[model samples]
Target: MKKIENLRTDYKRDQLNESSLASCPIEQFKLWFNEVLDVIIEPTAMVLSTYSQNKGVSSRVVLLKELQQDGFIFYTNYNSLKSEQIKLNPCVSLLFFWPDFQRQIRINGLVQKISHESSVNYFKKRPRKSQISAWASSQSSVIKDRFVLEALFHDFEKKFKNKTISKPPYWGGYKVVPNSIEFWQGRESRMHDRFLYTKHQNNKWIINRLSP
Candidate 1:
């Protein structure tokens, strides 16, 4: 390995402070997200982390589908590994990194499946091919070969030909209701700015500055 520790980048693109932050972390996330729309290739993509007693921890990048006042939303196969882990333990974490802006948002939250109606509505908006793939693939499952997958894809394509494709029962959306949200802004010399917002029992958010 080529001296991995020697590789580094000093971040000084922006600064974050208490006064500049929105009262609600969700609003603050929206502000940061909007600013990165033109700067990042996929501003809405986030790393989702889930844990199960048997499987330990798993993380993967998933595209964000929607943002609600209390939580974030994303869709996936209900039978997938991540979803299975979510069922085992609702507590999960979401991380959004925008290296170009030297900013990251980490959210610790509880995830719950959205209503089937809502999932169906979103499913209808997806491209026809994607809709078919959702039905064709058993996500996170082992398959014999690439041909097996291709064959299934072709079968589904022909099955849904010239017809409205319905959402698969195994595919849906999950919303993560955040209990805590932390925003990090990178600075020079490895010093960074961090702020955390914690939800109180009374339904108010308490903000605190964390040491870098």
Candidate 2:
């Protein structure tokens, strides 16, 4: 195997400073997100971390579907392991990494299920095959083989043929309301810049510079 220690890259793309940051972290996030859309493939992909009472912490990549003023939204099977963990502990974290830009954003928050109406609205917009697949897959559950899943998909497709596919009750969206958000910008050599925004009492945010 090649020497792992030999792999390294110096980050000199950009610098982030207090003066350059938006007073509101959400505003800053929007700016970065717009930039990410231009340069990053699959910019909506984010790592969601959740804690379970029995499983400790688990993480998986989920696509961000929407960005509301109060939080971020993503949909999934409500019966999945992540959902079970969220039921046990609502606190979760989201991470967005744009390596090509040498930037990352970490959000710590509480997750809550979105309104059924909202879930239905988004579900209605999904492709017919996706809608059928959502009903077929038992996410995070053990399956005997790929054929079993394919069979289930076929069954659902036949059952919903020539009909509107409704959203499965077991699938919906969750919104992550952030309590704190951290932005990181990689710099030349080993030096990096970091800033954290913490929600304070009286509904305001306090921004602080952090050591790399």
Candidate 3:
């Protein structure tokens, strides 16, 4: 087996230049997102990082459900550890790494729960099994064993049988309104291209290229 430290990839897939970038980060993100639609599996998956004063920081992979003009949105159980941390501190970060394109996008922002009506609208489109699972899973809570979870799923399944399942009270979506967004593209010889878009007080985006 090769030594872990000796294993590395010299990325030369692409280069990101200021002239080729969109003035609005969201537009740029959409451009890149559309380009990868056929290349990456689960292209909408992103790493969500949340911080808690007591627990420090935590990171997990979450699916990006919506990319609106202002922010990115995802749904989860309100009683989960991430949600508890978000309640403690609303600031968070999101990261998307597309290895096939040798690219990465980082977003730092504040999170707030999306409107209940919006959540309900999206929830209604979910598959019935997923809706039932949302109700069955307590999320981030500990249980004795697999049987306990399976039992809970079975119970909810029976309860919601032949009926439309509704979104749980503690389940919803959160939108991340970004203040700063960075796009990185890998280049040859360990040199990479990075562009950062920071929202100014006037609500305009200021783009800057960073040394890489």
Candidate 4:
């Protein structure tokens, strides 16, 4: 068996504190996200992880498409592995690592399907080709080859030619309502700064310092 190793870079960009963080985690996420968005070089992307009760575990790196008070939202086919996992177990974790900023945020939360209205609104904003592709493809399904997928996209494009592309019945968004949020800042050696915000019984957020 191959030996696994711990490979890490030292982090010393900034420090996080309960006093400086926004009372709401989402608000805090927005502030960090905007900073990442502004940096054209080495921009950070979102990493969404899903857990399945039946199929074991799986994860994918998806962009942070949108965010709201309810939770973090992303789109995918209803029959995808992540979707299946969510259907079986609505709990999942999201990790965002901004290497340029030398910071990482880990979120644990319950997942829920978003409303149809919101899905339609986002669908309309996508490029015309993407709209058709969403309608044509059964994401995560076994397929023959690249040509087959391209054919599907092309067929759907032709089918919806002149007409407005509508949201697919099987495709939509999901929100992850965070029960806990952990912020990590790299420091000297392995002594990293860890700030965790856990949800209280009264639905309030309580900040704690976790050993790193």
lDDT against the true structure, each candidate:
0.95, 0.95, 0.96, 0.82
Compose the digit string of candidate 3's lDDT tens values, residues 1-212. Answer: 99999989999877898789999999999999999989889999999999998989999999999999999999999999999999999999999999999999999999999999999999999988899899989999999999999999999999988988889999999999999999999999889999999999999999999998
Per-candidate TM-scores read: 0.98, 0.98, 0.99, 0.91
Cα deviation at 1, candidate 3, in Å, is 1.1
Count: clashes, candidate 4: 1
Q: Write the per-residue lDDT of candidate 2 for residues 59-134, one digit (tens) a residue.
A: 9999999999889999999999999999999999999999999999999999999999999999999988999999
Q: Residue-pair clashes per candidate, as listed?
A: 0, 0, 0, 1
Please give the distance, in angstroms, between residue 91's alpha carbon in candidate 2 and its true position after superposition. Answer: 0.5
* Stretches > 4 Å off in candidate 1: none
Please report, as a residue range, the 10-residue window in candidate 3 with the lowest summed lDDT: 10-19
RMSD of each predicted structure: 0.9, 0.8, 0.7, 2.8
TM-score of 2: 0.98
Compute the lDDT of residue 76 as modeled in candidate 1: 99
Model 3 residue 174 CA deviation (Å) reads: 0.3
**Which pairs clash inside model 3?**
none
